[model samples]
Target: MEHTQKLIHKIINLTPLSTAYEHTPKGKRQLECYVKNTCGITAKHLARIYRVRQARQLIKANPQLSLAQLALECGFSDQSHLNNEFNAILQIPPAKYKKLIQQ
Candidate 1:
C-alpha cells in the first residue's frame, strides 16, 4: 500500500503526458499492475487525465496563449489533440474555456 502510494505520488508529480514507465525502478508490467490494482485505472489513463488537468491550469494562468502553444507546453502532439482531450474532459473547447475564463 505504501509502495503504491509512493508510485502514485511520483506519477502525479511528473510532467504532463509523460506516461513512460521506463523511468520507474519497477518493470513496466509491475508498474501497470500496481497502478491498476491501486487506482483502478491504467497508468496511461491517469497520465491523460493529468495532462488535461495540467493544461487547464496552464490555460487558466495564461489565457492569451495559442492553442498550438498550449498543446506543445502541455505535451500534446498538436492543437487538434489538445482540443480533443480538452473537449472530452471539460465538455468544451479550449477556446471556449479561455473565453469563459477571460470574461
Candidate 2:
C-alpha cells in the first residue's frame, strides 16, 4: 500500500538508527508508534523479533558460544527463555537451527 510505504519512509526519515532507545520514554513511544503505523504490530512483538535477529548475528560471530550465553547477551532470561522465543519466531529449536547453520 502506498500509504503504508509513505508512513514507513516518514518514520525512517524521522528516526535515525543511531538514536538511543533504552533511556527514554520518548524513544519507546516512537518505536511503538512506528510499529503501529507501519506494520500494525505491537512493540512487544517487535522487540522479540529484534532480539531473535540479534541472537542470530551473535551465533554467527561466536559459534562456540553456549545457548545460555547467547540468550543472556541478547537480553533473554536464559537458554530456555531464548529457546522459547526462538521457537516462537523461527518455528525451530535453537540447537537444530545452530546445527543447520554450522553444516
Count of clashes, each model: 0, 0
lDDT of 2: 0.68
* Residue-wise C-alpha lDDT for candidate 1, range 1-103, written one tens digit per residue: 5555656775667443234454456676777788898889987778777878888999899999999999988888999999999899779999999999999
Stretches off by above 4 angstroms in model 2 are 1-34
lDDT of each: 0.79, 0.68
Specify the poorest-scoring 10-residue window by lDDT in model 1.
Answer: 14-23
Question: Model 2 misses residue 88 by how many Å?
Answer: 0.5
* Worst lDDT 10-window in candidate 2: 11-20
User: What would the TM-scores of all predictions be?
Assistant: 0.82, 0.68
